[model samples]
Target chain A: MTSYHSINFAQKISKLDELWSPRVISEMNEYQFKAVRIQGDFIWHDHPETDEAFIVLQGRLRIDFRDGAVLIEAGEMFVVPKGVEHKPFAEEEVHLLLIEPRGTLNTGHAGGSRTKPNDLWL
Target chain B: MTSYHSINFAQKISKLDELWSPRVISEMNEYQFKAVRIQGDFIWHDHPETDEAFIVLQGRLRIDFRDGAVLIEAGEMFVVPKGVEHKPFAEEEVHLLLIEPRGTLNTGHAGGSRTKPNDLWL
Candidate 1:
């Protein structure tokens, strides 16, 4: 009856149907790990208090900063420091594993139509 | 002059020559993303204040608890709650991405000869 269970990112992400909407996969302490698939562009935003870690599972992601951009590929990871303005772009479908605090907003400071619930577990 | 760089887990791990030694790949907030290759047995230990997150990059990992055990596989993740005494075992070489606080010791409370410096970076 233990609640602890292992998560296979490949299998979990393959079952998702949405784009850019992250679903909580697991958690450790105050941090929650999420999975999301994306194509095209995500609005520029900034989270003033928390740094966000992104692990690329499939394809590639281009994170654009005011001064430059960083390309993250499969089996790779990138950490976007707090208080930094950035946008995400994917020329092709990309799968990602995001690690951050439990109550973090996906849209950061630019909450609007693209802002999705941060607590949806997969 | 930016210090930011994307880390490729597969490529980085392939360069390692030791076992059970973790290398820091990236950091977000106070937590760090580390990569390591482990096989055989790891001593039982506990981190009283911080939870440990383990994501298998390749191969499988078996975590043993006093009351139960959890088997983790490639592309899968598992979180060991804080203050829990546990040991890790791998039938073969296993690649892992460990997420925990900056000061976390891999050996946890079981510090001895098995304990290693927690700040090695890839």
Candidate 2:
């Protein structure tokens, strides 16, 4: 049987409304993951040197790239490897947790309407 | 303020026993993390090609090394980089979550008395 403080990703998603914002859930080593609610369009950005993992806890999100795009729904995850320019957006509000090294930038290169400040705890 | 589906590390530790064994709490990407309860004396081993993170959820655990030993307690985390020979043990029961790439070995260099099989969910 599975046991250990089970983090209810669904339960958390029901409690917020906003876009491109995240909340810290827990920390391991020097890295911690933040769950955020996102909607509409996020700014174009990329993390030049770190790989990040995004897990869809609810709704849907699409990542736009220079070459193509990919859509992700709840119960799915995508790893945006470092140095890849990508933009994330949604038709409706979506819930997600972003996993990466501590101090990772929310925006990669084009930091204009959506680059979030570092260490904003949800 | 902060809110999200909070996974209680302390609450999880109160529910299990045994050594080098783990329990799954969540899944992301193709990887999942399992929290394990461990105790006295494990065999020396090494993971040749993956970085593993160990977060001490409760009690105290010590990682034995070829030249030194590091003690980690609750609220502490240690990363054992790939290809390092090490052993983990505790004076009493210690709770932890081992994070690494999916399919990484529990026992790396030498697999004898303490190498755990892959995918044993707690």
Instruction: Please give the DockQ score of every candidate, comma-separated.
Output: 0.63, 0.06
Worst 10 residues of 1 chain B by lDDT: B1-10
Q: Fraction of true inter-chain Cα contacts (below 8 Å) kept per model?
A: 0.70, 0.01
TM-score of candidate 1 to 2 decimals? 0.95
Name the lDDT value of residue B63 in candidate 1.
93
- Across B38-68, the per-residue lDDT of candidate 1 in tens digits comes to 9999999999998999999899999998888
Chain A TM-score, structure 2: 0.84
> Could you give the DockQ of candidate 1?
0.63
TM-score of each: 0.95, 0.54
Q: What is the C-alpha lDDT of each candidate?
A: 0.91, 0.69
- The residue-level lDDT of candidate 2 at B87 comes to 86
List the candidate 1 regions with Cα displacement exceeding 4 Å. A1-4, B1-4
lDDT of predicted model 1: 0.91
Q: Lowest lDDT 10-mer window, candidate 1 chain A? A: A1-10
How displaced is residue B90 in candidate 2, in Å?
A: 23
Cα deviation of B60 in candidate 1 (Å)? 0.9
